[model samples]
Target: MSDRDTRHKASMEKLKARVEEKIASANEQRGLIIVNTGNGKGKTTAAWGTVTRALGYGYKVGVVQFIKGLWECGERNRLEEDANLELAIMATGFTWDTQNRQADTDACQEVWKEAERMLADPETYLVVLDEITYMLKFGYLDIETVKQALENRPLEQTVIITGRNAHRELVAMADTVTEMQEVRHAFNNGLQARRGIDF
Candidate 1:
């Protein structure tokens, strides 16, 4: 073949390779389940970081705070105003704060049901189940229901479950599990949780 013809053939091959790369990248979907467990301060923070990242990408995000009520989460307050996000926090406060086991359980059941809807909805691209492990630990939420939600969530949606003492089964099922180990905490030294930093 002439030199010109050889050059044209090489260009065609390059174009074909580029088209294949585009197709492969487009076909790839994001399906991730991250569990932030262990004793640390940043579990929910890290999960919210992911939510912020997803929101920056124009994806719909749902945040479900299991035990924490509508009191104040700086991140939640900020994201709640965004039209693309939905915030559902159990406004009944902590179980101990409420001092009623049955009531707390009922409240968890109610909020968790709402969270379930977000998990199942394909339109929701990111679902953050914040402090859900506390619900499980308190027996307010069923582990199996949480497990099933993870299993049945939209294949392209990203899910985050953040709390201490994440169940082994949930950890096993998660695509990424981060265990935050607490070496030394200021709270142990009599420092209260600081605003914007801890809240």
Candidate 2:
């Protein structure tokens, strides 16, 4: 064999051994708290991907949407067709459009009732709290209450929260956190959002 071929074989062997060791070390299995947040896009999209995975596995999945029901969301339409998924949308429109703090707070409280129920449900393998951090950001929902619900939830049930500005408490509690940073976006260039792609 050539010298390059021998070196490549050695590199592959080393990588294979490292991967096996890491996999062997990872034995504990528990539900995760995943947070997707940042000023960029794709937070809710990532959470929806996870929800789709849970639903595909025949596991019950729950979704509670806030501050985003006004859009013509193709994802919501697709998710509704799944038998294992329970989707609730708070069509309260945007906060700036509503211009009523009290009304927004009332809407949040009503939707939160469903979220709390989903979190407590043992059969729900995954719950997506879409744009929930907006509630905490606007003080529509209390942080302590959310933290307690997450802590006291079913042991094997995972939760995903997606929004722009996640609270400090939520960040601290998350098992996995991903922040999307925008380098460039088409909309920023004065282009309108596309139907299925942007939504």
Candidate 3:
């Protein structure tokens, strides 16, 4: 082999050994609290990806959409058809569109009741709280109540929270936190949101 090729093979072998060692050492099996946040797109999309992945393993999933009301979402439509998945779209509309603070708060409370029931259930392996940060930021739901529900969930039930500007407490409590930084977006150039891509 060429000298450059030999060096590359050696480097890859070393990296592979390190990765295998780490994987072997990771023996713990428990639910994780994963957070996807930041001023960027794809937060809910990424969470849905995880939901589908878990479904592939025959896991039961529950989804609660906080601020996206009863809109037509492709993922929602597909996942709701699965016998193992339960979806709840609990919002009148976006906060700006609703313009009714009391009504929004009431709706959020009802959503939380459903979410808490899912959290308490051991059969549900994954729960996705899409756009929940908006509710927390707007004081529509109590942070302490949310935290308690999360902390008290079944040991093997994972939860995913997605939205921009996730609360600091939620960040600190998360097992894995991914921030989607916005480098560029089509919307900035005045392109309308595409059906399958944007939603």
Candidate 4:
């Protein structure tokens, strides 16, 4: 065998040998904050998948959608009916679309307060801050408040933040950071969002 092949084989053997010993000594890892950031679709959808999976495990999930107002995200419609989830929506729509900066900030603060409540609630195992980057982007909400809320959230609670351009500090603090790179998009071809696919 080549020297590189022999070295790779030896490394694999070492890794295999250590796995059993590590598993025997491992303790339950603490709950974490997961951030999904990028300029692509599916960030919120991916988080919704996590929300559903966590619900299946009987976890109490809280969802606070920051920029998207009362619009229908089918997941929210369905999940809100389930007793395992708490859903809060920022009924003021997007900043540019809404055309009222002060009103948008007020709406953001209202939803943010609810998010803060969920962060404090020990019963909530997972909290999804959907599209919250827009809140920070528009200055509707302070980023430090959001950061402190996440940092000091009930140690048992896992928070998931999803959006494009998540703050650098927030990404640094998150236990897991997933950045979805957009290679191709149907939107480029003038395709609009479809129900059950985009909301």
Best by lDDT: 3
Q: What overall lDDT, based on C-alpha atoms, would model 4 receive against the true structure?
A: 0.89
Model 4: per-residue Cα lDDT at residue 100: 94
The C-alpha TM-scores of every prediction are: 0.83, 0.96, 0.97, 0.87
**Which 10 consecutive residues of model 4 have the lowest summed lDDT?**
66-75
Error of 3 at 112 (Å): 0.6
Of candidates 3 and 1, the better by TM-score: 3
User: How displaced is residue 110 in candidate 4, in Å?
Assistant: 0.6
- Considering TM-score, where higher is better, how would the candidates rank from best to worst? 3, 2, 4, 1
Ranking by lDDT: 3, 2, 4, 1
Residue 38 local lDDT, model 4: 98
RMSD of each: 7.7, 1.1, 1.0, 3.2
lDDT by residue (162-186, candidate 4, tens digit) is 9999988889899899999999889
Regions more than 4 Å wrong, model 3: none
Q: What's model 3's overall lDDT?
A: 0.92
lDDT (tens digit, per residue) of candidate 1 on 30-115: 78999999997799889889998989988999999877755578887777777889988786887778899988888888888889
Summarize candidate 2's per-residue lDDT along 66-179 as a digit string, tens digits. 999777888778878888999777758788899999999999899899999999999999999999999999999999999999999999999999998899889999999999
